[model samples]
Target chain A: MTTRILTPEELALLSLVQDELVPSYGDLPPAGTLGAALTVDAYLAEQPRLRRPVLTTLRAIEVRAGKAPFAELDAGRRVEVLRKVENADPESFSELVKQTYNAYYTRPDIQASLGIDNPPQPLGFELPAFDESRLSRVRAMGKLWRDD
Target chain B: MAAPELDSDVLIVGSGASGAAAAWSLSRGGLRVTCLEQGRWVDPSEYAHSRPDYELARQTSFAKDPNVRGWAADYPINNSGTPIYPLMVNAVGGSTVHWSGHFPRMRPSDFRVRTLDGVADDWPFTYWDLEPYYDLNDSMVGVSGLAGDPANPPRSPRQTPPLAFDAGCEAYLRGLENLGWHWWPCDNALISEPFGENRSPCNCCGPCDIGCPIGAMSSAHVTYWPKALAQGVQLITHARVEQITVDHAGQATGALYYDDHGVRRSHTAGVVVMAANGVGTPRLLLNSTSARFPNGLANNSGVVGAYLMFHPVAFVSGVFEEVVNGQRGPIGGLMNCQEFYETDLARGFVRGFELQLSRSVGPLSVANGGILGHPVPWGSEHHEALRSRYAHTMTTSVMLEDLPEPENRVTLDPELTDAHGIPAPRVEYRAGENTQRMLEFSIARARELFEAAGAVEILVDPLVQESGWHLMGTCRMGDDPERSVINGWGQAHECSNLFVIDGSTFTTSAAVNPTSTIQAVALRCADWLGRNYRDVAA
Candidate 1:
């Protein structure tokens, strides 16, 4: 609940961007629905060097949307604004996209939607029994290198 | 300030794979052995693979990079000039705790690389000399492998059965068969069935590199250290050894170390064994300057920190139609194809490489950035790719043989120092032409294997410099004192009672993982020491 890393304005801009990156689609919730923007805030809180770059990008997007907050912009206008910002500072925009995707996709709910068990541990999935006959041919290849 | 001193019959400077093996052998042979580990034991409860926040846990605690993990006992490495940033762990089991448990023995041809290929220096002894010790170490550590691997020489029976093959390995095996290439189930240092009293069968938790919680994978902490401790081998944790104290006769008398409480202490012993790994061993030796040996202890030839070798790796990933469940089995590759492991004059490279078919990627790994030149797509395409590639991707690592180069070495940094105020180890390395050629050839072969397996999409990673896992050849072994630091028996040539029993004594790195050979050599060194105990104690 700590809002020290991201201000209300920055969080609102990030949420709008997160939704566009991963919109809700047929049983899968959008990035904003999973609270990924808050996760980004928490992640950047530990990495002080990355905090300014992310906030500056958000502020730029808001300003480019005609003096209006990014969240209040039309969906088409939001996409157009993001495209412009991406062209200007591609590396920063790419970093933002990566962080948003990572935070959204790693959530347990998102994992369930993707048919993946979140940690893949404690009760690990079992594989099909080994078919010995499949390896018979490779086993027959026999000593291809010079051992002596 | 005056330092407190302790005494032991035999003192080992590390508690890693080689150090633990030596401790087991020497203590069982009736010597009072003591091992000094710079890091503390890993808490089993803190092993976080079972939790939902596993990726976060890995970044905070279990990362391979020392600077990223930021453990207290971890030392800094100056990687400015090195091709690869050094990857190592500093716990009781050392890097073994985070290893993938790929245990392949060096071939007989590897021992005579100089005579056969006329490229690198040969080992002082042959593979036959260490074969028995390799079998012994395998039995001790419980290797899960088949008996007749056509790629290797005939060996004794394995302690356990081979790990069950997954769909990815099956496809790779079929592909290798189609290509008429030599392939075999990897000799893994993991228990497939219950063996030892404390050990259990692998449950396939898929995080073997992050310290197995169930004592299934044969890390030194769960395998050798327990037996060594039972034999009364004393292990002193959080002891950062700075230098080896030598006598006026150039004999190793003891070691100066900093304890957990930041107190400078000394441990005197009749014999001192340096099992502090390739980087740490050389750093300690170069720092241990004395009046008789002003350059460094047992470094009379100035080759103590030279000839560093690490396997230059190339990666390839293939996307299959079937759901292979890439995150189900062991973290390492399942099958090993060494079709080009030997020297062939037809190829540009003197020595060749090994291809390990790995299937251990997870959804998060794919999401972060798909490995092996397959960048994860963004926007709408991202979800579709993740759904398709998360369980369908198969990867291979082309482990190339790197020859001994004197310039590729670990030296002490002039400016940087560790928490204990000792000079940090600085690595300087670059891939030679031979390695580069081998990587090129191996990557092409890997792509062919993927194609033969009917992969839908094949992604090739030209070279990965960060795959510097096998640290070797910093304190090389040979017959002559002028050429090597240690002899065939791992005994220091310049100093009689000084010994080095680690990957640091490797003369030439083979095209495979080095842990099995490291443990085997340590066991051989211990046997030699036991036989010559009377001479060494004098």
Candidate 2:
């Protein structure tokens, strides 16, 4: 369980990947620096079983980012390509987005540095932001449809 | 590494409700009880936050072994008529840790089913006999409910009040009421408010099927193990019991088992309690071949693993207009109807079902429905469907009680050892004709109720007549040694000091959840062991 390092090039590619996936407002740091700081390569190296799937998923993300052969795309084109993929299949993009997010969120250094909000809470206790107006309207409509 | 040899006054196998309860009871009695649990203790606080971390990918659903590498079933959902079905949980607290916590005591008539209704065999003990122990078990586990339901026997005062039913739940209630069925609040083993020392109130997050993070649900880890530890019970986790050892005089000696690290060890005790659940209990006994008892340990009657039973559960789901945050709270949040419990010759089914009401839906479930055409009227139909339907829908799940038959039994496979190299419990089971009829009736009733509730579209999932969870009847209780595995007091007929306290000892499958009754019997057995230890030892 020792710390390991990710190559700078791989870190930059991972960052370029994350920048395209998450909503800009969702409080995430740039992926490259976070990936570098996380020792992503070392973690993956230890998990030999997950290596193939992880690589395949990253390659899929790169292709979706229009970085054919992955190594070619700049950061801007990667974002544009990801937006297209996200629009086409949000389900497939979700895993990549979540992985990139967790990659940063799980690292203690990145977590503290970014002030990410992933504190411990009881199971099923996470509250969604309440939009009273939306909820009230929904409730009113539901009342109308009541079989009672 | 050399495995440590262990010895104790009591060697209890399996750490679910039964083992945990026995451990607590024996430990409190000043006995050197050693509990051998195959699964390791997983701290609740480890993944308390981040509910998604404990999903299927995490593989920690309902106290089953997280490390189980392959699917137990050779194939998925058997649509063909296969009599055999598998049910099991291999975890620290066994299945009890992850159960829905629906704690209903078996009714008085449930025990004397053969004598009263002549369908199943009569249990050696009656509900009146188990009443006090049931109360004690309920109090220990902290059940929350209201009494005075005319259908059920009067219950002792619950530790807490029933959970509040949500707004959408009334629709289903009305439908059940319209059909002239009586419904009552379910007896839940969850803390509605603060109870005895260290226990906290349930916040009703609705994901009790997954491990409860706050310890509000009555898993054995929270309920019995704590008391057992306080009373000096020695719990040996990851020690899988292989066989029960008996001496030349037909007396119980102890057991042989392997630790998590796969080193074999032996423990000697005056009494051996096989609380290894319905499946595990019989498997261990059958595997314990010896010169004195070659068939199996205490298999004098050749009925070590016969008459297995589990209630066939069918789930129903629908779409409503408002967001019913169904993803929170313990399973079976509400119990709407049980008027069908009585046997009606006219209904063409021997046993009736108890309707469990719940509305907890997770994101995966929501996403599942959205693709299944449950949502919007869309395009032009969008606003109309979204405005009118989603929040108003609520579903009632029926747990149909199945009759116990000898053909449905447990036996060992020549193949399949567990991760620790112990043979896995091979279950041979099938739903009886009576149970099949009950499922058909229950499904039709469910559809009727939904239609009456003005459901625009109601989808009925195929009936799965078997679940491995509520396993019972393999080592059933009765009066005659030739016919039964255990006596009325839960003592083995062949071995006086040996006992089976879990669902394996149940003679009949009650229409409700079995955890409360299992805990109750464990407590009663422990009490009996405390009084009669000297007589048996001599």
Candidate 3:
């Protein structure tokens, strides 16, 4: 498929949301893949009939992008929004911005397409190739996330 | 969410051994059975062909997104920080997709562990009561083992030969004999030779914990699911049951659930079987609050989510000179030391434990744990430790039987909810004194076994997180309705048409794995339904 150049409005808004989500994102689009980050296919698979919720989540992110120059925001502000809207719900405008950013970048299909085999392991972590030093470090980092 | 309209003769929840067996039996009995599974059907060939991949799936891979449900996060069972816990499979086959296939029957003593030992409550039925169904399940699944052992209850001859043991098994035998402990080859569900069914002989790929790629392990996927499907069982996957609606008269009419599309759907059936597993089943029942039964569905005895138990596991490993080749066969191999299965007068623990002489470490597991006495930082020392431990390590797992304490229960957290906004099951559990004492005894025995095997260095996993894996007793079966959730026949005490045929019905946590017994009970329950309700049609 031919790469379509995003409209100026789309480009600016996408860049703002990307910056809000992942502050370190460079010149490229915020998504892990160059294409649309949140596809209808993936959304429908989990949320089936929740198109309104999806749209609402996306629109909130867009609204933040519409007002603020998200890319120019400080790292702390970017993180604030990201944490807020990380889920399908946005607790704040900053969260909306962050959620939109993450939603765009964290697409499974996009990651696969990008040949990025890096997926989060269960219990919020991953076991990489067996390296004694790394394993010891992680083991020593005991109870980083408390079950309580 | 609104409840969708659904109509069926029989609606079976879950897809594990009991669920699958019930579906198979019910479908064969000519009922229009609709089986609802929260997990999709995983093609074993696609995901679990190689040993490396299988290990990866078990040790590392997250469950598929849709299969990863709310209960996992809501109830934190594995507080040990390890990712592993009482992992319920979401796909059509359920946990049977990844079981060790050690299908031992509940010994005659096992049924009455409570009465004989004076610890817990006795099962309403006896071994003879469940023997025919055990025989049926064993025959249908092609159980393999040596049957002459006097330790276990007498049964019909195994349909297939026993699985071959490794050098580690030989050492275990010698060590156990030295300790004067009786050992018998495990009665597993694997076919040792070409059998009457579609199953093939065991190639011994040791990755049965994740799943058996080939047709070696007799999972419900190969055993009953296909048969059920062929008999016209309508299976709907990715369906998460939320509530069971009952009439004013207290008879179950149907259930409300989330379909694959996350759309609220409802299914009405003449009979509803809750096989959603110990945690899921109780959670659903507790969440199904109507004006008539506000506490939960069929919880008139106020015991829908009480008396939970799990086998407390303690691991001990030692480094040997020889290569054990642990990644070659079934996850559990050789014999189990059942000397501790029954309570001993000299023992501190009221209940007992079973020493499963299972396989040693695979290369990957050894690599993960640096060699014994070599806890160096992860550079050169780490590599050396992995190399030293890779071939020399052997492990023995102690499955300590837990007593069903009323305090150890499954309840719904008022604050927490699943992705679909349904209340999540909150688990409140603590290891009873009997289990802790059993662990202490097993730890001591494990140390002795390692020394007997001439191990240079032995390492035992610190007892930390207690799991709810062998989940049972949520809806226990007994003679009195006031005491138990289900009747002796596995039917709900309040609702006759509703049956609970999973680990939830276990009255006591026997030292043996409960999957096989659960399957037997499920098959028997199905037979009862068939003989009783033959006139019901699709």
Q: Judging by lDDT against the true structure, name the best candidate.
A: 1
- Over the stretch B40-149, how does candidate 1's per-residue lDDT look in tens digits? 89988878777765655555588777867779989998988787777888999989887789999999999999888887788999999999999999989999877777
Expressed as tens digits, the lDDT of each residue in A26-109 for candidate 3 is 243433234332332233345444344544554555555445755566656655544445443633333233223225434444
lDDT of 3 at A85: 54
lDDT of candidate model 3 versus the reference: 0.66
| Candidate 2 residue-wise lDDT, A1-148, digit = tens | 2334445545555555654442232343454434532444554565454445445555566567552644477656665665676666655555444445445434554434333233223423433321223223222322110001
Question: Best candidate per TM-score, number?
Answer: 1
User: Chain B TM per candidate, please?
Assistant: 0.97, 0.90, 0.91
TM-score of each: 0.94, 0.76, 0.74
DockQ of 1: 0.54
Cα distance off (Å), candidate 3, residue B225: 0.7
Off by over 4 Å in 3: A1-148, B1-6, B48-54, B62-84, B196-198, B370-377, B464-467, B534-538
* lDDT at position B217, candidate 2: 82
> On residues B1-538, what C-alpha lDDT tens digit does candidate 2 reach at each position?
0112427777898888899888887777677788888777766654433533333322223423322323221111221333424444556677765657788777777887787677878888778778998988887888888766566776788888877565545556556656755666778888787886676777766556656677788778888887888888888887777888888887778888887667898888888899988877998898888887788887878888888787777656554444454444454667646667768879997757877776644332232242122323112232234324333445566777778787777677666666555666666666778887887888777777766655566655535433446878889898889888899878989888789999999988878888889988998888888777766641
Give candidate 1 regions above 4 Å deviation.
A46-69, A72-98, A145-147, B1-6, B371-374
List lDDT for all candidates, in order: 0.84, 0.65, 0.66
Considering summed lDDT, which 10 consecutive residues are worst modelled in model 2 chain B?
Answer: B71-80
Model 2 misplaced regions, further than 4 Å: A1-148, B1-6, B48-89, B368-393
Deviation in Å, model 3, residue B504 alpha carbon: 0.3
